[model samples]
Target: MTSNDAWWRGAVIYHVYPRSFQDTSGDGIGDLNGITQRLGHIAELGADAVWISPFVRSPMRDFGYDVLDYCDVDPMFGTLEDFHRLLDTAHKRDLKVLMDQVLSHTSSDHPWFLESRASRDNAKADWYVWADPRPDGSPPNNWLSVFGGSAWQWEPRRSQYYLHNFLREQPDLNFHNPSVRAAVLDVCRFWLEMGVDGFRLDVCAFYFHDPELKDNPPNPNRPSGKSFMFNPYSMQRHVNDIGQPENLAFLEELRGLCDAYSAVLLGELHETDAEKLHREYTAPGRLHLAYGYWLLGAEEIGAGDLYGLVRALGHEAHEGWPAWALENHDFMRAPSRLADGEAPMALTAALISMRGAFCFYQGAELGLPEANVPFERLADPYGREFYPAYPGRDGSRTPIPWNADAPHSGFSEVEPWLPIPAEHRALNAEDQGRLAGSVLARMRRFLNWRRTRPELRDGNMDMLDLPEPVFGFVRAREEDRLLCLFNLGDGPVDVDPPQTGFGTPVEGHGLDWASHAGRVRLPRGGGYFGELA
Candidate 1:
């Protein structure tokens, strides 16, 4: 492949939350063999790559994000040999592998963290972020954990407070320390040497903290809706808590490591300024691409919102490539959040066909809704703490539905770690393997269709200024031009073309372009495309 064939650029990545992707071991949780078994399905869907959530050795405190061993695979997932098999199978199928690398923190059970926390002046004492508590016997500052409460955890042995932007079991690593950054880079090198194509850096923005340990000021107006909307943490502007400038230098260092092997890094920026930070982080010589939480939010999808997001990044930076995603391990599926369960196929078609590289979570292609788990079945600690209110991420992390007729949707012979929704049984891969009109079939069709259009693969977007809820954009590269339109609302929308120079419906969804009286009628939650003469 040539430099222009930088596969990460404009390539669709399928995010397989490993624990939910497949369970070939029949162990109730997804594992490496399970992923190997599903590679064909991913390749068939037209995805050029796969981003598997952390399969590294973990205590499962934060469900694999809290890494216990960077160089080894957890037994729950499988051995390192199993991962090699998955990687080999994926590459054999011409698909790249982008694995998760959680840099911000590590599980308390990790050897490094354990050694660091063992004593005040141990060999790895400064490896993690540790600070002296205030004289008042309180946490060092007002910084809050994303999981909830103060970001500091008191360690009695050291008689100090340690910073943890997430669960207390997951302590934030001090990237400000050069040695710590070097060790993390070594971890990256370990995987890249193993032929891993790239990385999805978890909490890419939350790597550093204020040395002064200042307080985060309160946000005068907090955003509402979904889980965190009601939480007080939303009320405070998380300035000192995360998105520190010290992170950029470390990112540059990591980029240097990745560049040595031509490995791509998609930094996952989970912050208030995610889009802005995404632009800053992905600028040349920094990150290959940057994705944030905007697409995962519960905001209603609209033509205007989608167009605005693309335009925002377009205006924000010129050189940095943008990567977009609608669903992932942490968020509910798009169909469930959009309330467009009525026409999810059309919605998925519109989403994947947009102007940038997009990601589809496991089970998303099947149009799976968020499975509601009762309090007794909940496994996430965050959910347990805020029960009956903000249920945790387990709802979206259930097992993949493979066979409709098999018990537990054929995810496993044993009971799944989380309950599989009965509705998902009808939408399994086996049910759609040979049929049209199924969401799985539609995903395969749209992804394949999307790859054939070079204009879409690598082009600039010219958003059409049409009526409300009608998303319109012209994907243009060199001489090729394709007008893509979408009806993101629940009513029919009419698009009066500037002129009838549309030669034909180029991408071929079998729509009648001759009847397009220069005025195209789009059904509720539907989309269409046309090629200019």
Candidate 2:
């Protein structure tokens, strides 16, 4: 492969949360074989790559996010051989593979942590952060976990507390230690050498913690935002717990390691100042891409909001390449999150067609609404605690619907790990695959069209001043310029004709445009882009 291909530059990445993707066995849980079986579906979507959530060996405390064995595949997912098979099959289909790498912390069960906690003077004792308790015997600091409690967990055997920004089962690694950094870099190199294309660095900003273990000051304006309301961890400024300035060096070091294998690294930025942090993390030889949760969390999405975000990133993105996503394993589905609960396939197409590279969660292409898991059937620990107040991520993690009539929606012979929403039966892949106007087919057509447009692949975006609810943008290169217009509101709207270099309209693609009037009629919740002549 040519190292400079950079196929991921403007690629559409399909995200596969392995546990929920497909189960080849009757185990009710998905695995690598299941993913291999589904490769055809992903490839058919015109996606250039697939980003699988973490599948490394783990104790399942955080569903594989808390990594145990960095170099081996989890039994729950599959063996190493199965993974190699997956890579072979995916590469044969021309789809790049990007695995999730959670380096911020490790499961307490990891050998490194086990040895670290065995004694204070052991060979790897300092591999993890270990601190004595305060004189008052409370937590060393006021830092809170994202799961809603103290971030510090006590280790009775060591007689000291270890830092865990998330669950107690996940202990923060001491990246300040050169030995630990070298070990992690070796782990990364192991996978890159195995022919993987890239990595999605999980919680990239939380790589290092405050060396002094100082108490974080309270945020004066914490209660007004999503971070504060969703979890108490947002109440503090978090300066002492994570996102330290020293992280830049680690990023560069990681970039260097990736450079050796020509692998790309996309960082998952999870902080209030994520955009600014993304710029620094991806500047020059740092992260290849950094994605923030700004759009993923927007309670409502519209033409104005979409244009505004693109414009802001356009002006401030700098050397940092932007990666956008409207749905992922963590948040609610966009179709349901949107105010009207109306299927917004056209709007989704428009959003993805914008300048940045994007990732789409498994069911997003089907316009699958969020499955409402009853309180009694809730499997997510976070949702169980939050209850009616805040449902957990499981709502968006239900199994993919393949057959509308098959028992368990054809996902498995046995019951799926998650309940397939009854309403999803009618919208299964089998049903939608046959319908041209269905969300699934629309996505297929859109992706196919997108692949042929060089301007969309690596081009600059310019927002046009169109009417409200209509997001108009121009994607251009030295040789080609394409106009993309979208109506993101209810009811029909018409606008004057647009000036273009091309004359013939690209028919048979769900688009009807008269070059004379520019008065294109769009149905409610429907969208299509016309090629300019």
Candidate 3:
């Protein structure tokens, strides 16, 4: 696998949120040194790579998402020397390192943004998205930021409004500006030269906005049942604000740059028609893989829903590849969101069996549910702005519990940036590592088993048409086939045998099924895997 050029195809990549992973400096914040020390856990867990969230220099307003410097590591995380050492150590463990690249935006304090906002005639004045006020001194268009309120922020120095899809401090970069594109590409080159295996592009779709600055029409599907419905941002069609066709050309240019170093590109696309966008963004000479908010933001986890999403994406992404993640930094944990009795371990098994590369968020293997954070302890700006309605992402970004008895669960010497959940203390990694049938143990077993099975790793997947509560799929690679069946419901489900013959059951940890006279009964949170004849 290390020798393969397309190692990311069907690979399992672990996402390490630096702030929650570990804190070696005793400053109540996780840093590069902590991640370097924990690379062994990821390697032993059978992950091919690790995708680290932003640790670049930032103002901490939006955490590391608001970058002030692209080439330097934040002092909070470590020095540039520390990052080089971390990268070297990770590679020694046979783990590829992927850094988070927030190319679309930069902090208001960033030199580029400061210079751009200083005066209208400055050399970098056009570096960021800026426009004059409308006739009534209002915003140029009806673009709303994801964090709430208007996307345009008033810059008194230039008497112009700058576009900020997220926090006001994080202004969107103007990719239409050739110099800005070159500067961003140079940032990529600097990290590549420093030995980053790849990058996880943040807000990939918001890179290029409509050149004409036309107003976005109101969303016809008002009161859409999706999350963040309380905010007006969801009520707009966003046709003019994002997902511009010009983004494809820029992505191709970015892809060409990455190809020079043999690095992979994974994009995080946000759009209503994500499947269509994923197809266009990942076509040849662009992103190697693109994952959208379909699974991450989905409220329903039924068999039909999972099957439809995977099938639709498979059909839409012609020559491109897809990556799947049940949970990430932005979403709540699977156990908290899933139905009662549907074990997080079961969901982990189901995710690994899917026909694409997998990204497992940190602490997910511990069966960690969403934590309860007091209003006073909230740190997420998004949550603060939409309080009561949306408590923000702080609950999901709590520190990882390493020891059950240690103060702050061995995350920090002092209190952490976010409160550690009492429930997670009982499910710490130290204790779970020694217990069989634990979520962590199950994840280790399944990931190790998945590595040996070519069908599950990079083979063709065919969804089985089983009855409700029973979702089954078959992964095949030429002469070999592995059949996977999962029970998404809480109670037991009796399922008829598939038309295709099933071979002897293959052991996958404790996942088992009872077959009697062509009828199989699966217990709650149960899964079965067998060789297909």
Candidate 4:
């Protein structure tokens, strides 16, 4: 599809965490060259595009999230020429590229922040959020950082407090400043000119905070059993600290800039009222799509829960598109998060069969579970602070196993930044690619199968009311309709066919379903797909 077709719509985008994808430079850390070398693997997986995590210049404090330079690549990843080669090679392979744009905050070492923190009278002084201390010499408000502790950091030079929604090294940018907005837009322009297809806006909701710096109210019902359960940041409703009204206007400006290049914009949103924010942020001239952690952060996955998520999004996301992801660099792997046996396989089918765009995380096709990283080997600050309880993201950020017998699982010639899990070696792409019924093979088949069926891609999905453990939906595009039924449980279950005309069962990627007397028998972790009569 051409860019004019808005290819992001109903696209299957693979997420690549550069540090773990592959390491060609022998630095034990994956880089742009590694990713470029692996583009063939992604193309072979049948993904339309790749959403690469941050590879910009950084101090590695928060990995690449704390960007020191937006326009340049870090030496760790490679040089600017390497990035250009990557972009060129990916496009030649018919794959679009989406870079991670950390517009919310920047490393304290960034030149902009350095100049801004120098003095209040400097040209870039107001580029970051700065506030005076309260009369008691405490923080201006009750804002809390997502990484734990106070959001406000004292700067002795200005004798003022600056806001940092994450680590103290990553200070929040002041979107209230028109110049800051223009500068960020210019950063986007630089990448667009360099041939990036689009960007995945990091912490898009945290762009503009409340102008008054008001205190956030406490949340009466804090969610339990989540990766962030121990985080005090979850205790508050976060009304004023994020999801500000000014963010919409700023997004419109960014959209205008992107529209000039026909580039897509995807937002990473976290809001108390996520559905509402998704609707507002993607309405009309805003972000092309917005996705929250409704599925990613769930401790349990149930049919009702999955149905409710889609139903809610269908209702709230009017005039806007939705993007769904089962696993990413930030969350636990789907196999470990979901049930054992065939449940992970079923969930993968369900994720790809959904109505909207899909973001398939790297190594997820191999059905890789969360790796068990020892406390001594942990490199994630978030996990270190809440160790044993949360275990941080290191478990999910381990290197991708390419070859089972190669040193470091073929990720690097030397030691990797994070140890490759032994379990992953058994599920390496090299081995799985040869197995007929492996998750990787199944994923390739399913994704390629999805491409031929318009009903599964850009079709209207209607949720079917089925019994427990069975979630059914019909994807229809004009006269073509496909019935999709999935059993989320481990035990075999029986489900009745829809009252509508039912055609013969369509061939699927090893998913078995037998129908007799209008009753369909679905094996555990099995699903059925057929054309509507």
Question: In candidate 4, what are the lDDT values of residues 210-290, reduced to their tens digit?
Answer: 989999999997866656687888899988989989999999989998988989898988858788888888888999877
Kindly list the per-residue Cα lDDT of model 3 for residues 354-469, writing each as its tens digit. Answer: 87788989988888888889999999998899888888888889999998888999899999999998898999999998998788887888788888887776777887888777
Ranking under TM-score, best-scoring first?
4, 3, 1, 2
Give the per-residue lDDT of model 2 (tens digit) for 1-533.
11246676678889999988888878998999999999999999889899999998998877898899999999988899999999999999999999899988999999999999988999999999888888988888787888878888888889999988778889989999999899989889999989999899998898788888888888776633332376776678777777889999999989988888878898888755676786688788898877888777766777778776665555232446778888999888887776767646657667667766788899988888889988877777777767677888898999998987778888887988889988887789988999988888878988887787777767766667777777777777675667777777777677565554332345544533333354666666555465553
**Could you tally the backbone clashes for each prediction?**
0, 4, 0, 0
Model 4 misplacement above 4 A: 1-4, 315-318, 339-343
Specify the highest-lDDT model's number: 4
Predicted candidate 1 versus true structure: per-residue lDDT over 1-533, tens digit per residue: 11344777678999998887778777889899999988999999889899999999888988898888999999999999999998999999999999899988999998888899999899999988899988999987888888888888999989998988889999998877788888888999999999999999888888888778789898875765574574677888877878888878888988888888889998888647667787778877888888877768655766677777776676222557777787887776666666555434555566566655777788877878888888899998878877777888888888888998787888888898999888877788998878887777767877887788877766766766777776677777777778877777777777677443444666455222224556777776556788875
lDDT on C-alpha atoms for all candidate structures: 0.79, 0.80, 0.85, 0.87
Sorting all predicted structures by lDDT, with the top scorer first, yields 4, 3, 2, 1
Misplaced by over 4 Å in model 1 are 1-5, 315-317, 340-343, 499-503, 510-514
Worst 10 residues of 1 by lDDT: 507-516
- Candidate 2 steric clashes: 4
TM-score of 2: 0.94
Error of 3 at 346 (Å): 2.8
Worst 10-residue lDDT window, candidate 4:
338-347
Model 3 lDDT vs. the true structure? 0.85
lDDT of 2: 0.80
Which of the two, 2 or 4, has more lDDT? 4
